[model samples]
Target: MITPSVSDPSPRRRSEKSRSATLSAALELCAENGYGKVTIEAIAARAGVSKKTIYRWWSTKGAILLDAVTELVASGSPLPDTGDIEADLRTHIGSLVRLFTSPVIGPAYTGILAELLHDERLARAVNDELVIPRVALVYQRMRGAQEQGQLPPDADLPLAVEMMYGPLYYRHALGRSYPDEQRIETLVAHVMRALRTPAPS
Candidate 1:
């Protein structure tokens, strides 16, 4: 049989496998050692790939960590939208609480947030990759609610989005879990009430 062509699928398959392994290794190292202690060399060693392979795909360890997290969040279940704004907000809040309390992703996120104070680039990367997408989803759903008259058309969606999420994040940053469904549901209901429009005088 003739030899395989230069543009063979085998090399491409190996490249994809190496990339996935690198991401998984990065996540595992971050979870185990915390973000500050993890390094590219350790990731390469854990991934069984050369350092060059990682550099070829990522500029810094932070970037790799971000990719690892973005992959997880992107692959997670989509935010629910059953048309009842309050219930949907509660569902999304519940999902976010679970994500932040997760053994793997939670620590990784907090570790990065701690690093963010020192490294502006890492902060920007995290904001662009992690925060914006989630915020965008919330914005879209809330804007739709405004359109549906569930919220006042004049309601400030951006602020409402922040208000809905800011407390949960603050609690996570303080190392406090959401406590229970009752607490989260109560918070969601309160936010919904604040976002609702008043009747004309």
Candidate 2:
């Protein structure tokens, strides 16, 4: 309604508006009424689109939520490349800790992750679409560190990345105690130690 819904003559413009509306509605509903209570019908109603319109793009409610999350994640801050791997990891991981605790996206994303457990198809798509791409970005940063002799050349980057995030993800996904600044700092310290990066001499 705000942006010339009276309406855009271009089909692409109409599609873009509809997509944005649907994604926004999904996030709003999830935040207002817990992810479990967010249904496709509710999203369609709130988005001002028919159920068929939603289904034409997404197979299920989870798929819609996944797309919503991917859009938000894509717009978020990228990993810092200040050239000090330890400092960079701390900054990046700190951002993630905040993301896990974020009120808007946290609950919705946690729900999608839980849904992934029962839906094998969604799981594969999430791994391929969301998780793997983010992981790859970190790996790219660590590879740079290897070239600079910050992390050892043979460092187990994948496992080390896991070590950085596994505990935090476990707590956040399970709705456990929060990962506050101190807790995140402690985690970063522990993982950096495991990397065996040389200290400034």
Candidate 3:
């Protein structure tokens, strides 16, 4: 009796292709119909894959969306890292504002924030996968500033992060208005001022 040879599929390549297709379809559907209206069936249809294929990898639509947004934000843009902390932060925040204001991203962001309000799991996933990495980058920059004596030794890094991000997120997610260049510049200046001032002795 002849025996068939055992062979394993290329897991890395297969997984990469699967992830790419899923993210592409998720972003497309999310942009077109908003996240609330997108279903696994719709994403699978757009991706030309079986629903089982998506479900095999992701447990929920939000999970798929989280991955999709992370990929989109990471791929299209490089986070700013100028040696000057204030300049770098202004560049970073400006890029963020442009991203949030884009026609392709605005609605998707709004949808994601809306879902996050109601879904703890999805919120956690988004925070872990996307927000934390970027936040860490900002923190690293702040630490570097402290080391360089650009910011006071006692600067509150976490509060500084919130100060930089709070206005941008609030304006975009709540007010539905994009931050203008002047607003971004002012934010950077204010944060820099706060960073420079020494904490009360």
Error of 2 at 114 (Å): 2.0
Model 3 agreement with the true structure over 1-201: per-residue lDDT tens digits? 554343544667676777788878887888888778989999888888888888888998888877777776766545565668888888888887777777676667777878898889889988988888888888998898789878888889999999998887787677567768988889899988987877788
Error of 1 at 99 (Å): 1.3
The lDDT of model 3 is: 0.80
Whole-model Cα lDDT of every candidate shown, in order? 0.82, 0.82, 0.80
Q: Give lDDT for model 1.
A: 0.82
> lDDT at 9 for candidate 2?
57
What is candidate 1's CA lDDT for residue 81?
77
TM-score of 1: 0.88
Per-residue accuracy of model 2 over 29-78 as CA lDDT, tens digit each: 99899889999999989999889989889998889888888767766636
Model 1 over residues 1-201: C-alpha lDDT tens digits? Answer: 555575655767889989999988988888887878989999999999999999998988878878877888776636777988888888888777777677777767777777777889888988988889889998998888889878888877888888888997788778876647898898888777777746355
**Candidate 3 positional error at 187, Å:** 0.6
TM-score of every candidate: 0.88, 0.89, 0.88
Root-mean-square deviation of every model: 3.0, 4.3, 3.5
The residue ranges of model 2 lying beyond 4 angstroms of the native Cα positions read 1-7, 197-201
